[model samples]
Target: MTVNGRRVPVLSAEGVTVRIGGRVLLDAVDLDVHAGEVLALVGPNGAGKSTLLGVIAGDTQPDRGRTVLDGTDLRRWRLGDLARRRALLTQANSVAFPFTVREVVAMGRAPWASLPEGDDDEAIIEESLAATDTTHLHSRTFPTLSGGEKARASLSRALAQRAGVLLLDEPTAAVDLRHQEIVLELARTVADGGGAVVVVLHDLELAAAWSDRLVMISDGRIRAAGPPHQVLTAELVEEVYRQPVLVHRHPVTGDLLVTPDRRGSRPTRTPVAPAAGAALDSAFVKEFS
Candidate 1:
């Protein structure tokens, strides 16, 4: 497939599985990501979302199936070539030693070391910072920045790579609510710019809000894969999460929203008003009189 002069189906996996200590972490899972599209992987904790990202990012090889990038097996690509064409932002990224934001963002350029260091690099770095809304933090130390700020900086580093495929694992974790929107907006911008994005998200609402397609995983298998409105139904949520959830369209945008119902497990009880002329009421009335 092709989209806006970029390759559609930029990354794909077939029968991918991961196992450890004879325990299956992921079972025969499959997914496809296209350029100019955002595909979200959503599931509960221990559902293999992050492990799937690792498989797609070439950090881990599937035990049973194949991962293909742009029609070629991912294993065939050279490390440098893969680095130049794809970027992976893992869940935990920390700067042990203090480094300025600019230096950190510059690390994204490591794959293109042969290229001349000139205005282009600076421009790319600046654009990445601007896209992630971290330009103001250029002079700040990475260790001194807040958790949200660090996430934005890491995102900027990935953007600076200018790769055609982007993979993220829990990109919004540890960020404040406001920064969550900011990070997701940047992801949308990346897709709009003709890149393919695959993200693992814990928040179903965020996934429904931003994803062009969704893949729901459970017990390492693909439970559902399709548009959010179609795949994120109440029945599917209950089946995969073992909990009741309500699916409703946003009143304004009409986007699908998934909300877990905590009251599902508790019996409904109606409160009764105190009976008139009861002993408690009579005592209060006598005192007042």
Candidate 2:
């Protein structure tokens, strides 16, 4: 299959299987991640999206099969060499030290230390900060930043790596609405620049809007894989997500929009509590306390 007019696969996962304590996390998963395309993985919690990403990033060993990068097994590549070819942005941005934002981003250049481009670390770091809209946070300590700020800083660090492929797990989960849009747009820009991007996302609307292709996984298997419209049908989503959903094209952008079907459900409202000193009936106190 063609990806952004490119016909070659930059990353390939063949029969990848992961098992933990005899429970399958991913079973016989085969996928081709192509250059110049943004592929989004969507599924319910515990569906193994992050595990698959970990396997592809060479951070986790699979029980069977292998992940290949540029026709070579990822297991055979050196750690430093693999870092140069791909960057992984995990869901958490936990930091124990007091490193400044710039210092954290500068660490991404470690893999290029032996190359001439290593000298451009400062320039790349600045560019990555600006691209992620975190330039103003350069002097702040990473451990002191808020969740959203930390997410932006982490993305800047990953972007500074300047790798050929990006594996982002929930890159936008902690950000606000605008930053969420910014992060996804940046991923698209990376793909447009001939890099492959694989993103794990929970928002079906955003995944449908941003991804060129979608992979829906459930129960440790791929439920569907194809264009967003093909993979995000209302029937399939309702079945896999275990809830009713409405999938329709937007009137303005013509992009697919997903909304939960709540026609038969009662509108949710908070009940007013009794005053602290007010008398309570024995039945009410027994039910609550």
- On TM-score, the candidate that comes out on top is 2
User: Residue-pair clashes per candidate, as listed?
Assistant: 0, 0
In model 2, the worst 10-residue window by lDDT is 275-284
Q: What is the lDDT of candidate 2?
A: 0.93
- TM-score per prediction, in order, is 0.87, 0.90
lDDT of 2 by residue, 143-240 (tens): 99999999999999899999999999999899999999999999999999999999999999999999999999998899999999999999999999
In angstroms, the error of model 1 at 217 is 0.5
Candidate 1 lDDT, 1-289, residue by residue in tens: 6668865588998899899889899998888888898999998899999999999899998889989998999999999889989999988769888899999999998888877643478889998898878899999999999877888899889988889899988989878888899888888988999889999998999999999999999889888999888889999898888889889988998977788787757889876567844867788989999
Each prediction's Cα lDDT score? 0.88, 0.93
In model 1, which runs have C-alpha deviations exceeding 4 angstroms?
3-8, 116-119, 264-289
Q: Largest lDDT belongs to which candidate?
A: 2
